[model samples]
Target: MDNQALSLNNTIVATNANVLSMLSERGKNIFFPKLGILAQAAQARGKAINATIGEAVEDDGSSMHLPEFDALVNMPTANIFPYAPSFGKPEFRSLWKDSIYRKNPSLKETVISNPIATNGLTHGLSMAAYLFANEDDTVLLSNHYWENYNLIFENNYGATVETFELFANGGFNVADFGKKLNEIEGEKIITLLNFPNNPAGYTPLVSEIATIVAEIKKVADKGKKVIVLIDDAYFGLVYEENVFTESIFVELANLSENVLAVKLDGPTKEDYVWGFRVGFITYAIKGGTAELYEALENKTAGAVRGNISNISQLSQSMLFKVYSAPTYEQSKKEKFDILKGRYDILRDALSNPKYAEYFSPLPFNSGYFMCVEPKKGLVAEEIRKHLLEKYSTGVIVLGSVIRLAFSAVPQAKLPELVENIYNACVDLDK
Candidate 1:
């Protein structure tokens, strides 16, 4: 055998021999960071405020009253028990596609494929990673991204992540983004964009969104294949009037063939059904065909078949009924208003002068959570533990930033929650 061939064989065996090494190089290096301990302890301790989980809750801290969706659970027999197609129920796929475009009317002229169902938005991203990226391929993401993306893209798919600073001057950093895209020359790239972003909870302004679409087109114009995945998991939850209201996918879909736009979204956050696990992946390739979509759908279905086989039938059935109902619009608005109330209360409370001594809030105009960078070199992990043990308040701490999911916190409780956080930081200073 050739010397190079023998060396490659030896490396493969060494990697497979160590069970941990079977994971991609990136996976072997991850620490599986967790901060759910506070949530768990809060439950056991009782009356502990939970600012951890992102689900919406009632004023008394109970789960949101979703009487409107009760009928979804009692669907006709065929909807409940039988297995669904690996791709999804055809009607559900069509309905989801219609719903997406209906909400974002600017996409009416764009060439886009029908939506394909997955277990959740997370699985949709995983499927996209499997299809577009290969071992050691680079994925450009913002530095402040959801933690799960690491496991899905890098660990499982063996892709390497390249990060650009997510914020500059309190907005999207277009110049830095363009620089990063140009730096890695002559490679087909996969770039991920998440709006109503997790942890930070900021969506781009209209001008920023336009720049993002233009930037990807420039990359594609340079003859490099660019797959842009838009993670719109927290779609349409914006609380501000000035922020861009639609998915940037609409403009991107109309761009060059070299750029493929894949949108990952679901009813989990939109419909307030966190446990439903019903999400979709829709693609757009200019001048693409039904046959092309079918081919792409088959590969995604094969992945789902080999793994979970299919998403839960009951979940899809429930979502279908919810989508089909005439009252769905009104029901969603009711829940949105509730979340908006909580969002506004938190915004107002954070504006209090007293809290400024502890931390400064980041740019947050939408979504479930808002992040803060603590003052005085305070460590987020230490403050998290101090808040849990001393004040019985639970918040998610990521590195030096602290994230509070106001969606789960009642409007009436906002003042107290802010007070506890202030106290926690002051006590830690001593």
Candidate 2:
């Protein structure tokens, strides 16, 4: 049978045996291609300013300024080189749960279980897709989302990707989301939410988050299985006072038995250890028993074992120490302050009157990046290429909008970055 028929018939499974078949059908995606091409160009052209990359770049254009978990570096050979358990160390899991509560105090009353270790947030998401989503399942997301999700749900799991408007009237379109949920013809539907959202770094208002939870519960009440995967890769980076401080995981977790809240987060962006590649997959199933969580853990561990055998022991050990450190909270606060300062620069720069003719900045106050919609008669790809060829500037082009990784751009160089973008618009116009 042809690939199309296989996909239509739902015969292709994302298992080791059918890997080739799955790749033939759903593996083609554009995120990595654009990222790879621009990343290579950015590196090859020395002195080029690359804002397309997502990792937290130092203000001086240096490498990621990660936390100093020096104790791990000097630890005994056994601690650094030994294999981590497939499910992660018991103490490490416990420490992570404690850290989660500290970061999200709202989750303190929302009975939850320990998180399972994954290679990173991406891996955690991939595993969740494999375990929960099936071929032909519909995974819903915001219109403004990280493109890797396409690779995870549609490409890898053979699931259908649906989207709802991320914003309406300068706020989250909760009504549209609910409408989309009801429209999807499936008993099982997955909603993947990322905040502070990538590409367009916006966190919803607290009431907006509550509306989302209520919508999910309404669907669950109608006898549909809903998986709400909270991608908190950029957690705790909110700048505005109105935005919710806690992860929406707590509220969704308390909603209904048919609703499952899966949180994917890591030290990559949170702790500034992008290279460490340490992350977690935590669960919140309403009225879930301890036994159920343990089974979920084992299944998740099995998925991890089959995929990469196990994550890096060195990374896990190092993170374990950081989680248990006496000054971990203080260290996180210091880093947050730095990112917040950079965010302020981007916010002020975007608000300048000069850029209004070029593009309109989106509503954003948190996260590492923000987005802008180019004026009419302009194409995002054309603008991106013009910026690269004419000015040696690199930014991501997503449909009609362009993303600026202000987090990667230096504070002093912010003005120059803005000038370059505006200049690119002028050059393209000419």
Candidate 3:
């Protein structure tokens, strides 16, 4: 390992041995070089005779860019063209950190590492897996998950993904979660928790969140190390009153020294900037200090530097501007209301007795989608094919369940979409 990596490992070990133990082999060897090109470039920043980096810049310290590309965005060319710091723009990182506190009020008193930018939530998860997941390591998640998780964690990193039934008795299956955690045979456990879960779109209620936290803590209490990756990609999209509005990260952050919570979230879904490809990764653990977090941040930045080098400067800059706008919250609420309207239509449509015979709707109150399992003697893929061919409707089929994205359909078209799905199932059954 490089001396810098050794130094970082020592620092992490000194602060919290459990955290150091959770790192994978690659993570242990990865370090942000303090004497590298980026470091020298930083030292030469604002110099009268600086030529440390490769990017072309005018003598007046302005970024050189084509007028055609520069005219597209209203912002300055420097913000659009410059290479963002590997950890992300300092101002933007701070702004996002503040927003986390604002959105998750329970985290105001808690201490967490500053957020580091990623290309998107998927990249954020890949980064976390790079840092913590070792070959043959088991990743626990809900059975109803985003399929890409298998590509990111298992295929990319060679980790094993074990699943627990996502729902039991019309809510989160806390018992199954605890059972799965206990079944894993190791002192180190990594789990990814995605709320407003993909496909199912279910967010746990407050009591459910409390129970989930308790279950994680139980594992931590057993002298085991736990790394919780909270994927809050579809955060702040809840339509129902009883759903847990705050992130479960708030409870997991300071739960135990044996547990480290890494939160992956960004503007993709929260601010309706899906194409921006900007996301963030944050760290928190019990008794974590500023120095400890800084060390982790450096390692995380090293990972970022090694991977994509850095996120897009234009995306980060544009989002920073959007976040600063006075109308940002109101605009987000406006969009949320539209999605909630669609959700209401789907929920009411699914409640009808006619569709229940063909398909059973899963419990869902948040996020972009909800799933339904075909009734007995019906095949989900057959229904999906029937929908596509007969009705020109598209829906995702996973095993026996079909996922419907209410977010994609117009409010007026949601009922029709649901009806088409039901018709497809009936056609397949016949």
Top candidate, metric TM-score? 3
lDDT of 3 at 5: 91
| Model 1: colliding residue pairs | none
In terms of lDDT, which candidate is stronger, 2 or 3?
3
Tens-digit lDDT track of model 3 for 248-363: 99999999999999999999988888999999999999999888888889999999999999999999999999889999888889899999999998899888999878888899
Lowest summed lDDT across 10 adjacent residues in model 3 is found at: 421-430
Model 1 lDDT tens row, 44-125: 5445665654446667655554566556556654576556777889999998888888989998867577787888998998
The residue-level lDDT of candidate 2 at 429 comes to 77
Best of the two (1, 3) by lDDT: 3
Off by over 4 Å in 2: 1-72
Better of 2 and 3 by TM-score: 3
User: Local distance difference test, per candidate?
Assistant: 0.77, 0.77, 0.92
lDDT of 1: 0.77
Which candidate achieves the best lDDT against the true structure? 3
Which parts of model 1 have CA positions greater than 4 angstroms off?
Answer: 1-73
Model 2 RMSD in Å is 13.5
